[model samples]
Target: MANAKLNVLVAEVPEVIPLVQEAWRAHFALTFCTSLAEAETLLNKRFDVIVCGTHFAESKMFDLLRMAKSKPKSQAVPFLCIRVLDGELDGTAFQGISIATCALGAAGFVDLNRWRREYGFDQAREKLRQLVVSLAHQPT
Candidate 1:
């Protein structure tokens, strides 16, 4: 299905729905789930990429990440974890979370506060585009 758009599942809070839709709808088929449980259920289906909010970190997000890594259909899929900060994102906090998720095998991360404040979501959009292209190029 080379002509079909990639599928991306975003497990994030309601506040960020519009932003995510704006950034990824044009390039991929977007599915939005507001909670970790919902995301876990959706995982039974196929998605080329999974984007999770920091709020999910305390929930089942990590379990889902592990599932993706182990499942044959999603073993090579990439996951991006985005964090929404209370105020300006502290460098240390950002690093800590990034390191944690990466250690758990996330493919990448995006700081929502940074994306909105500094880049108007351009960086986030680019990161997603990169994932889409990279996945497309991989041998099935």
Candidate 2:
């Protein structure tokens, strides 16, 4: 375990907080934020991963990624976007955003209901564990 405690900043709804926390607990030192400002504050420090939901008000996925790209500390950080809905994700949604120029590291679009049924908290934790291990081993 390179660092068992991975700093994770999540920007999602109040209801989703517990679920995300439960899901990622094994792999992350979870931090839940209802607002983008709070998320941004955490971003200013160190983070191994970021899990963002679709409903974040002030900043969306692209906005956060762009900010991450600009920051020297977070340039290689892995970003995961959690889409609650069951539709195709439009890459164009982030068009014209500065982060659009950079390839998004890794993302998993999961239907909230489906995730609960099939890949619940335990499964999510396993997935995150694998992801962290892989990222940690990658050459900079």
Candidate 3:
């Protein structure tokens, strides 16, 4: 039998779905949710990773990270939070949010603008690929 594709839970804004799907759907079995509440409902299910898009300093993405870390089934799953830049914020502000998210249990942070400009996730993609490969090789 063929191996199952890795499952990914994407909790991001609606407008960013196309970009995310183009990058992830081909490799993983993706389930998209536009809101934190919707993501919460699916927490009981299994996912290899959670990719979230941050909106502000205290965005719902952080809450999801905390909740996932607290859950037994999902606690080990990695959460990658992508910081979106609108050209209005400085690097300091973005760093602060990324730090806070990591403190709250996010596995890592990615700069969305950098990923877009690079036409891919760049370093973030490599990290995620490593994570997926590691997860796939683990015995159940």
Per-residue lDDT for 135 in model 3?
A: 52
Give lDDT tens digits, candidate 1, residues 1-97.
Answer: 7789888888777877897787678888999987656766787788877877776635556676776677677666678777754665689977887
Weakest lDDT window of 10 consecutive positions for candidate 2: 93-102
Clashes of each: 0, 0, 0
Instruction: Summarize candidate 3's per-residue lDDT along 5-105 as a digit string, tens digits.
Output: 88888887777788667766777888988877788888889988877778522368778888888988888787777766464345787688778878988
User: Of models 2 and 3, which has the larger lDDT?
Assistant: 3
Q: Which stretches of candidate 2 lie over 4 Å from their true place?
A: 1-3, 85-125
Model 1, C-alpha of 66: deviation from truth (Å): 3.4
Candidate 3 wrong stretches, greater than 4 Å: 1-3, 56-58, 116-140
lDDT of 2 by residue, 1-140 (tens): 65567677776778778866676677668878777567677777777666666666544766766666667787677666665544434445533222443355444443343444567756755665576556544665
